[model samples]
Target: MNIKIYQRGGFKDNHDVLINATEYFCKMLMSTRMCNTLNIRLEMRSTKLGKNGLGSCYTDALGSKKNKDFIVIVKRDAPITDQLKTLAHECVHIHQKATNLLQYRLWKSDGKFHARWNGEELGVYDAIPYQDRPWEIEAYFLEDIMHKAYFFNNKNRPDLEEKIINGFNNALNYLESERSNNYRNIVSRQSNSLEMAI
Candidate 1:
């Protein structure tokens, strides 16, 4: 597993700065995810795949018969929230590809861009599992949870808890709208699935 993050020196506004900081934290937190799930530290590596203003991801499918582990790349200067969302989205892709390519779903396909997934849309996470649109909903939720976690973990934040709560509420609004009825269904199914397996 590989997760790399870089900062671009040119940030013109406060929002831009926040976005940059968010990207850095989000990338680091992704390593924690990889560690918990794959039981290894995700390596950080610089890639020549795409320019900072654009986006990118690459993989070799290491350590298993299928797409078990792989390399990923992204430009250093993308928006933090959007980029974090994309990162979570791409991780979902890796999960999908590993699950016998059954989970990979890119709706309204664009050109070959790994991190710039789904489409040029607001909610990219919900664009997975093609036939089952609920995956994107969960992806968006995961991104928010991670974002709030990052914000709360940030020592520099003056009002960290408030910011996290507000961000979560905002995310909930969007997810509630996007997932509609399937939100409860998905959560219920997930709970039951875990219960039976455990």
Candidate 2:
């Protein structure tokens, strides 16, 4: 999948700021050595307006693939360095998809699609398990390594730090429990189906 990162801005300052964020994220990804394993293509662009966002992976032809060509677009208003965290978070999903980690992540919950991710299943575009699994553990670890001590401490973005810790911890726990329950049910269903088929 080709993932494009777009930002909004035409000035030199915008480039400098955005560059700061991009370098940090790429370095993190490179250091993690994830790029060598994941085949997804990534691109970055800047925009002048719109909420900083990441994503792209519409289903493939015939609705089998939820989103094939992925794109992560972000606005220039956000502190580029901080926004990179969001990219890191999403990039983990891309990694999961590239490696088929998703096959084990999907679970049916209340007739709806769900994953261990902080976001909804809709984010993954699949009722398929593991499609949109949570990356909270990875996100938190990366945030601490990349932001909490350096950016957050030096910039005094305590509020951001509080939100990251609270949100990541709470979301990860909920997602884990939900995923476990859903997986159990899915296994039971699969077993029953196999028995019936035989």
Candidate 3:
């Protein structure tokens, strides 16, 4: 996936970690072909969200049957662990949208948001409580598991922790040289090593 992260308000110190985590989530949830076709933008913001909201995922159709473009807005002021968990949660929603497992449509006549899950209409969106939403249920269930898998449960990659530490060091260098117009591209190249490590 082509993932771009914009640090808008605060918590700008962990770009590399965020990038690696996003790539990991994409790899875990989607096939390689799907991953290659996706264009994901992650916006980190310090603004407050409703209630306990930590992040949200907005999927766009991009004028095609396949919805390949997505924007994920995450609360930046939260702890890094919380940020990663929220990111994992949003990534699951992206996967759901991409695979057509979850979808929403607005009815002009009734002005109500309708949801469909696995091709079955689920009635008005607001009718379903937050915890009862199937999509949210899946996302919430997998968030911490994905986070733990990326960090602690990667027994197959014994060197993962070392690589992440090294990636953070490289991130500092990248931040220092971020004035370059090709900074994103540069970080993309640097992230390749971490991806391999993952």
RMSD of 3: 15.1
Tell me the lDDT of model 1 at 74: 39
Estimate candidate 2's RMSD in Å: 12.6
lDDT accuracy of residue 96 in candidate 2 = 40
Poorest 10 consecutive residues by lDDT, candidate 1: 112-121
Error of 1 at 61 (Å): 9.1
**Tens digit of lDDT per residue, candidate 3, span 43-70?**
8876746667789998753322557889
The prediction achieving the highest TM-score against the true structure is: 3
Runs off by more than 4 Å, candidate 2: 1-8, 12-34, 37-69, 103-198
- State which candidate has the highest lDDT: 3
Candidate 1 shows a clash count of 2
Ranking by TM-score: 3, 2, 1
lDDT of 2 at 86: 55
lDDT of each: 0.45, 0.43, 0.75
lDDT, candidate 2, 36-94, per-residue tens: 33333333445322343443332222222323343444433446554555555555445
Model 1: lDDT equals 0.45
